[model samples]
Target: MTTSFQKKTRSKVLQIPGAKPSIYNNQLLISTGIPSLDHILGGGVAVGTILLIEEDTYGNYARLMLKYFCAEAVMTGHSLLLASADADPEQILKELPAPIIDDPGKGEATLEEPSHDSSSDNMKIAWRYRHLPKFQSNTSGVKFGHYYDLSKTMESELTQTVDISTVDSSLCACDSKQTDGEFNNPGYNSLLKTIQEKIMANGFSTTTQVEKRNILRLALHSIGSPMWGEKGGLTENEMYSPALPRFLVGLKAILRTAYACCVITVPAHLFCDKAYVRRLERLTDTVVEVDSFVGSDKEKNPVYKDYHGLFNIKQLPCLNSLVCNMPDSLDLAFKLRRKKLTIEKLHLPPDLSETANRSQEDPLKNLKPSSGCGTGGRSNKLEF
Candidate 1:
C-alpha cells in the first residue's frame, strides 16, 4: 500500500508550481459522456488520441457505450468512420444513439462536386467535408472509389471501411472465391488486400494532417483476431508480433487524415498470453474498459439486455482496454488510472424496466463460463 508520505510526494510532483515554458506535453483525455468518467479522464480525450474499448462477458455492452461518443460526434458534425475487420457494422450501430439527420433509407448521401470552373477555395472546402470513396478491391485490380456511398449507417451497426492509406494493394493475399467459410481461410483475403492497397495507393502520412470539417471518428475494430484473417495457418506468435506495429503505423496514418480516432479491440482474454495484450496497449493514447455489472430489480435499466450496467467504464494501463478476464481489465484500469479507480452506477433508459425484470428472473440461464479467461461470466462476477 502507498503510504501517506508517498501520496503527498506524488501529488506534489503532479502539482508543481510552473516555471516558465516547461516542454512537458499535455495529458490526453476522452469523455465518457458521463461526468464521473470525464472527471476520471482528467477532461475529455486529448486531441489526436485513440480510445480502445473492450469487454468479454459484457462485450455487447462495451460496444454500446462507445456509441455514446459516436452519437455525440455525429450530432456535433464530426464525420464518423467505423471500420471493423470482422463484425458487421449494422450490429455495432444498434447500440449507439440514432443519427441526427436520416438521409432517406439506403445510407447514401450524394452531393454535387463543384465543376472545374469553380474556385480552388470551393474545392478545398468540398474535400474537407465530403465522404470520399475509401474502399477498394486490390486483387481484382478494381479501384472502386466513389462507387459506393453510405446513405445511412445506423448508430448500432459496426462499420467496415478500408482507409486505403495503410493497406498494400499490390500484394493481394486474399482470395475472393469462397463466401461461406472462415475469413482466415483465404475467403476474406481479397478484402484485406483491397484494404492494404487502398492504404498504400492513397498515400499514408506520417505527420499529423488536420481537417476542420471532417473530424472522422475512426474505429478500427478487432484487428488481430485470427477469425478475421483469410489465409489461415498463422501462428499465435506471428499474429501477436505485428499487432502493435501495424496499429501504430495505421494510427499514424489515421491521425494524418482524421480529426479523432476510435479503436475498438477484442478482450485481452482472446489473446494466448499477457504479452499480446501488452503489445496492443502500446499504441493507444486513451483506453476505456467496458465493465459489466449485475442487474438490480430495484432500479431501471437500458432497453438492451447487455446494457444492464455497462455505465461502469474502467480505465486501463497503457491506454488500451483489454477485457479478457476480470483481472486484465482491472489490471489495465488500475495502471491507466495510476491508482485505485472508483466507478459510479451506470444509468440506462427507463423504458427497459420490462426487459430488466424478465432478465433478472434467470440471470445466468444464458451465460456460460468464459473458456478463454478464468473470470467466468458477468452473471457470476458482478454484484448488483
Candidate 2:
C-alpha cells in the first residue's frame, strides 16, 4: 500500500520575491529578484553558494548586479546585509531599488477585504462531491516581505554588518572570541567566523520551516583595494594576502551549513595570482564576468546601443535533482537603464515600432536614381 504525500508536503518558497525555488520541492532555491536571472539560475541561487562577479572594465557593472541582489533581498525581508567592500556600507544599502507598492488610488485594483460573516460559511459543497476537494491557496504569502526605500535612511533594525579589510593579527583568535556575538564592522576573518556562528545556530531550521527561513544576503564588494590596505603594489600583497584564502575557506564552510547566500564581487586579477583566483573560483559556485566581449561599439550594432555591458555566466549553480522547477539553460543578456539593471536571456530585439517608421523621414527613399555607368542611361558593353 503506497501512502499519499498530499498533506505532508509544504510549499517550496523562498523568504521573499525573486528568491526561493518552488512550493513543493525538497531542494531550496532563492530567486535573484531579476526575473530573467532568477529563471536562469534554476529558480534563484541555492542557499550558501557564493556568487563571484568578476570585473571586466571599471567594475561598475559588477557593482550594479551586487546592488540589485541586495535590493531584492531587502525588499523581501532578507535584511541581514554583510558588506565587506571599501565603500560605505550604509550608502550601498541606501542605494537599493525602492519597494514595489500596490497602489489602490486612481481606480487601480485594490486588495479585496475578507468577509467575516457566518452566513458565507454555511454555503458548503454538496456531500456527493466532498471526496474531490479543491485546494484554495492564500495569495498573501508575499505580505511577510519588507519594503525598502532607496532615498531614505534605513532604520536601526534593518541592519548592515560591514567587514572591510584589516590586518589578520588585529583580529586574532583571542580577540575574535571576545567579539560579543556580533561581528559588526570587523576584519575579514572575523566576518566569516561570525557568519559561521549564525549558520550553526540555525542548524537545519531551513529544511523544516522553509517559509519562515530568513536568508543572509552578503554583498562583499571589491575584496582587494588600496583603501583597505590589502594592495601592496606589484605582488597582490605577496600572494593572496594573509586573510583572503582563510576568509573564503571559512565562508564556504559556513555556507554549506547555513541558510544564506552570498554575492561577492572582486577584481581577482589585480589582487591575486592566477592560482589564487582559481582557489576563489573553486570555493565559489557561480562565476560571472561583466565586460564588452560582445563588442561595446555603439556604431556597429543597435543591441550594443541599448545594452550597457555583456555578461558571461562562467559557472552555473549546483542544484539537487528536480527537473521541472529548473530552467532549461542559462544564456543571459544585460541592460542598464536609468532606473533599473536587467539581466535576461540573450534574444533578438523586437522590430522597430510603426510610429518610429513614420517619424523617420528618409531623404534618400523618395529620390530617383541618377543615370550611372551601368544603369538606365546606356549599356556600355563593348567586346574586347
**Which number leads on TM-score?**
2
User: Candidate 2 at 46: error in angstroms?
Assistant: 1.1
- For all predictions, the C-alpha RMSD in Å is 20.8, 13.3
Give the CA lDDT, 0 to 100, for residue 129 in model 1.
42
lDDT (C-alpha) at residue 24 in model 2: 39
lDDT per residue for candidate 2 within 242-265, as digits (tens), equals: 455656777777677667788888
lDDT tens per residue, model 1, 203-294: 32223332322334455555445444422223434453442345455665546443344556555556666665555566665556554543
How far residue 201's Cα lies from its native spot in candidate 2, in Å, is 6.2
Off by over 4 Å in 2: 1-19, 22-25, 102-186, 198-212, 232-243, 269-275, 292-303, 321-331, 347-384
Error of 1 at 213 (Å): 4.2
